[model samples]
Target: MTVATHPLVARARLLADDLLAPHAERVDQAGVPVSHVEAVKRSGLLGVGAPAEYGGAAAPAAVARRTAEILAGACCSTWFVTTQHYTPVKLLAASGLPVRERLLRPLASGELLAGIAYAHVRAFPRVPVRAVPERGGWRFDGTVPWYTGWGLNDVMLLAGVTDAAEVVFAFAEAREQPGLRPSPPMRLAALTASRTVSLRLEGLWLPGKAVVLRTPQKEFAVVDRPRNTNASPAVFGVADAALALLDGVPEAEETARSLRTRLDETRERAYALWDHPVPHERIEERLALKTRSYDLMRAATTAAVVAGGGRSLDLDSRAQRLFREGMFLLVQGQTAEVRRAHLGHLGD
Candidate 1:
């Protein structure tokens, strides 16, 4: 379907394609893509998850999915970074009425750049962080490493354990807070345009206003819904990128057809749970399908690598970037191990 049929997604595709195609080499060489960030902000896309009340489109999961897919076709890293913005804000919007006013408005308007810092590299940070009581609020003294897009984000939905709660979002700014120690941006395989950094919170403080969830041991918002839809567009985008590569290969039309069917199968199954969280059986089945898709991404990248040869290894080759970025699928968490876990948990 044409993006114009859904203006927001259409716009997302156009910008992603433009920046990703022309600037892929530049982004890889320079590391990080500040220029595209500016373009994204200007396109009103930064506000994708803000409530309509705050002048945002406040689009649904479907639109978000389409936008991601379009962007992924050109640059998976950019697409990954792009998805981080809205879903987290959507989480903020769900934090009862108080949070919506305090953080949602500026965030939706692109007046703020924000990110989620929950992955601790040991797995997900499924805790409220260390929230010792303080005046009017609690102090957050901990670190969430591998926080992607730190440099551009003005706010962060920091998750931590506060003596209660399984997961919650903390609204934090890039302030000179005593407890919050931020590192210079780190290097990575892709999406380097974002300011990924290690955040050490010694005495980094937060006001009650910044703490979005205070309920102990309870999930403040629903991540299951959006996270599912959020992945499809990008996965599809990778497929699109793969197809593009295949078109240049010998018997490329046959390769394209074979790949497209697998891609379509993936899209259908991924979207099957759009209206619901993936059931245990479906999740396991998808673990296999998703693993297959990851393999496809590598295979496609290999084609680019083969076609490109040594030039692909050059400092200015799109093939190398594709190869590096395509490798993300390998770790995308859709392997047999995860499938077995899901399968084992089927009856539990």
Candidate 2:
């Protein structure tokens, strides 16, 4: 079957059309409800990239990316919450560690949703969170400044840096516990429905069996840098959704067609680099395409707002939502390198 016809992709489309899109505005204003998350879990889209033996579809990367686009376009807030599940699944699938046997199946099968607390690891020398060796396990102390899907997720893959400069990733129940305290969710300009909060890890301890992956900071950066260089599929998804707003406006027909062509071209180049066999090669090219995608996303979302006229300023406006979401995407997974490159591109 074609990627479009893939079961997981088709399920994503159905979920997007029937549920996510219809309630996106409501969810945006009211915060994403537990029911919306339950619908996603039942749809089985959670296991798109997981191993088949673990009750997952084990679909190709193309299928996974396509599903992400559909969901993000339909409701970026919902997409953001669910998107955190994939990383833990991926790490566990590749790991021979004891944690793999324990959490992989449940996560891959959508029986358990996982959130991530590892992005702060990107700070490197600044190390906001620290992991110190303890009694046959580890002790994590410090703060996770940004943790999304807090109350909604069943577990979290938390990370902290050791004095040896090793990045330690481990699993813990995502809850208020003995040593883990979560701050109230922050109100943001976009995707506030995602339930984002800060985590304080004061002597939070996990057994060695809970550990997933531990790698040297430099080695981790080697893999992580390339991944961040690629354009996020969500960018195209939100852009396409915004362009559709223009397509429906009679006076914006020419503008819609012109922008669609540019978007398609940029998307093709970005994905080609994303799928390249050698991820580490063409680093600059990847960053260039990524920034280009961001530019197009901004333009498309802006056009949508302009076409929307004064109504676009309303809280329920899809155009306004997409525009704010686009703004959020600009800094979503930003790294020093990405920021420098994007700013440099803007300067040029």
User: What are the clash counts of all predictions, listed in order?
Assistant: 20, 0
For candidate 1, the 10 contiguous residues with the lowest summed lDDT are 221-230
TM-score of each: 0.84, 0.99
Question: Model 1, residue 164: displacement in angstroms?
Answer: 3.5
Model 2 Cα lDDT, one tens digit per residue, 40-135: 898899999999999888999989999999999999999999999999999999999988989988888888999999999999899999999999
Off by over 4 Å in 2: none
- Would you list the C-alpha lDDT of every candidate in the order shown? 0.64, 0.93
